[model samples]
Target: MPQPTPDRDDQARLFREVVLVLGGVFAVQKTDDETIRRVAAGLERVYRRARQNQRSTTSSQALAPHPAIAGLLRITEAEGDEP
Candidate 1:
């Protein structure tokens, strides 16, 4: 006897549905305290490192003046006007 094979299209649809369900589970976990704690504990270091790099990049960009603004400042200073 031969075993029954699943339809390829049905298998693909099932895979998509599983991904969608997992996404929904994560979305729901965003507000659930127990799930949040479990996820945070598991990914705390990964999240912290990502956030740290993000903050550092944002702050450095914020602190650095744009090249056009710097050029304007230099022109004003050369003209003896305070920038």
Candidate 2:
């Protein structure tokens, strides 16, 4: 099983926060340039880490109780059509 790297987890939390703020601004139908810049900065940090290192076992995309990559599996008890 893979665990999330500390950095990535922090990024996810930060992203959630940003969304909250963005939503608030959107509710008022106002654009906050500063907020957008901050969000962009956060995304840049995430991208830099992703480019420099592979995801840890705990990356969000890799759900627990399931393998990180599902499409990699091509098996079934009964034959079924590919989605």
Candidate 3:
């Protein structure tokens, strides 16, 4: 049987936790906007590659990266692009 998907509330809570952790890392490391954006872009590339690998190997339902992750990457990339 397929596993049940997380509810929206659970997803939101998880997203918040992820954000908090990332924020703490940034604060602790004093990461600049450019570095953050580069990190995010690198992460996105890795995520996509992993997803492709998983899809090729698995017959089970395909998993997606969270929207919050995608959003964060997009925001960082966009911010880096700005002066």
Candidate 4:
């Protein structure tokens, strides 16, 4: 099943949370443009790393087929049949 995508409200909420967290972490009461930019860069790095890890894990799992599928594959190979 296809997953539902986040709406603009969800995105806005996430942005607000990021800014709030960054401000708290940096000990700044107000978020400046430069600070927001820096925070955005850092967040992007973290997001990319997370996505990469997910992809790697998914690919590794895909490399290992179910036992039934593995058996069928083996049989097909033995019969010189293309799967």
Best by lDDT: 3
Candidate 4 residue pairs that clash: none
lDDT of 3 by residue, 1-83 (tens): 85535554554565567657877899899999998888677656545564344444544686676997789879979997999
What's model 2's lDDT at 25?
71
What local distance difference test score does each model get?
0.59, 0.65, 0.69, 0.65
Instruction: Show how many residue pairs clash in every candidate, following the order shown.
Output: 0, 5, 0, 0
Give the alpha carbon lDDT tens digit for every residue of 1-83 in model 2: 88988877986786678668766875687667787788678667766676467655664574443462244243432235645
| Candidate 2 whole-model C-alpha lDDT, 0 to 1 | 0.65
The lDDT of model 4 is 0.65
Model 3 spans > 4 angstroms off: 1-6, 38-83
The deviation in Å at residue 45 for candidate 3 is 11
Clashes of 1: 0
Q: Number of the top candidate by TM-score? A: 3
RMSD of each: 22.4, 13.9, 16.0, 17.1
Tell me the tens digit of each residue's lDDT in model 4 across 1-83. 85535654565576578667767866656657787788688777655565444433334344676897699779868886654
Instruction: Give the lowest summed-lDDT range of ten residues in model 1.
Output: 51-60
Which residue pairs collide, candidate 2?
2-57, 2-58, 3-57, 3-58, 4-58
The order by descending TM-score is: 3, 2, 4, 1
Clashing pairs in 1: none
Model 1 residue 46 CA deviation in Å: 24
* lDDT score at residue 7, model 4, on the 0-100 scale: 58
